[model samples]
Target: MAAKDTKNIKLAKQIYDALSTEFPDSSCSLETDCPQNLAIRGILSAQCTDKRVNITARQLFDRFPDMESIASQEPEVIAEIIKPCGLTASKTKSVMAFAKKMTDEWGGVIPNDVDALMEVPGIGKKIANLIVGEVYGTPAVVVDTHCKRVMKRTGITDSEDPAKVEKDIMKAFPEAQWISIGHLSVDLGRKYCTARAPKCGECPLSSFCKRRI
Candidate 1:
């Protein structure tokens, strides 16, 4: 490995240790009642908050009860229930597609594979990683807005692209940490390294964060 790359690895260890200590309880904010339900919540979580997703998902599940129930419903009915999540027309299609996949294709099982999960409309790379990592304990990096911002600020990656940020994270952290690192970055982003006004003095990574900006 190049000398520069080796130095970055050491930095990764320090940041990982500091974050692990500062946010030991870091976890996915999205509610996970069941694999299938969590998948549905993920579909609703685009551009939406976790609290909202949880509430909306509960309402959806209460009315439909099962994947087959959701699959059988008219698209308009599903849209009405999930309208609060925003992107109603598209989200409705994704939700119904996932439900139908669950009932007819996967035999009521949500797959651990990222590609399979992404086959459903509106389930992109980030959500796919979330579903596989959170549901199946698979090692995957989810590069959401918080994670993307935190990573760039901390010098984990110079690029702003989610795919590139994910690559940098995978290189910096080991497979064992693949899941928790994303959650930890999110915690840091929310509590300290916020976009507008970061709390650097209180941030655990302030000591070595390259941009402290």
Candidate 2:
């Protein structure tokens, strides 16, 4: 193989190995019994902590267990239920609109296609990628804050834009490793490679990480 191809293979192996060792049971944080709920939860998670999203989603789901109920509800009511997650006004609109779209257009089902999912309000590229990957078992790079930051520090990507970072990661790693790599990067960011004061000494990729600061 060429030098670039060899490097990509090596990086893919290293990442998979490290992630398996670090977070063997890793998965998305948003709790949901169904894939549609998981997609809705992921949308509500924007600008909000996963804990708060889980709590609010539980309460909201109790009253509105399906797309029809959520679509029928007023945005203000939804906002009140999800106030703890912050960005309530926008999130409420997004959720309500998303629910309506799913009910009317999607036949009360979340579409497995990323493009179709993105057509809904509040479902951006990152969240759409995540939904497709987690719910539909499609391989994709779900670039979040953690993945963007860590990928930059590790010299895997230079852009902070989630879309650009996703492209960079896809180029660096193999298709099979894309989903788990995002999860692993988030774990590394939360545990050792933090933004403010990264614990580089404890990081498995410390030697390979370009950012020592």
Candidate 3:
């Protein structure tokens, strides 16, 4: 292996081990009962906090319990329910359209492949990867804003673009550890490596982080 590759491998191991100890049971923050629900929540989570998404999703699911139910409602109705998540109009359209396809064509089954998932309205690369990683147990690198921020700050990747960040992290870590590190990076971002005013001293990865904050 190249010297830099060997160094990155060692650093990746150290990061994985450190974050494993810090957040042993890290997982996606969104709460859902099934892959379909997870898919909807993932869409709702765009430009929104997971806590808000979870809260809004409860109201959304309460009104429209399933993909069929969601498909039946008008986009306006779903928009009203998810308004708290912001960008209600677009989110509603995406959810309604995606739900319609799920109900009418796919019979409410969410596909595990990235390309297939992207075919659904509002299901972008990050969300697609989440569904594939969490639902299908695939080796996926979920590069959400939090994952992007933390990884960059931690010196795991220097890129600001999420796609490039995902690719870089995939190379740094083993395939088996990709999902775990993705989840851990989010945890690190939320708790310590926050976008502004990060608590660098309290961060477990402080010693290794480039402290881009």
RMSD of each predicted structure: 1.1, 1.8, 1.6
Residues 1-213, model 2: lDDT tens digits: 667556755765676687679899888877857887888789888978788889889998998898899999878888888888888887888888888888899887678888888887788988998888988779999898888888888777778888788887888888888888888888888899888998889888876566753
lDDT winner, 2 or 3: 3
Candidate 1 has a TM-score of 0.97
Candidate 3 deviates by what RMSD?
A: 1.6
> Can you tell me which runs of candidate 1 are displaced by over 4 Å?
none
lDDT comparing candidate 2 with the true structure: 0.83
Off by over 4 Å in 2: 1-9
When summed lDDT is taken over every stretch of 10 residues in candidate 2, the lowest stretch is 4-13
TM-score of model 3 vs. true structure: 0.95
- Report lDDT (Cα) of residue 118, candidate 1: 91
| Per-residue lDDT value at 176 in model 2 | 86
Best model number under TM-score: 1
Which one wins by lDDT: 1 or 2? Answer: 1
Q: How should the candidates be ordered by lDDT, best one leading?
A: 1, 3, 2
Worst 10 residues of 1 by lDDT: 2-11
Question: Which scores higher on lDDT, 1 or 3?
Answer: 1
lDDT of 3: 0.85
- How does residue 13 of candidate 2 score in lDDT? 69
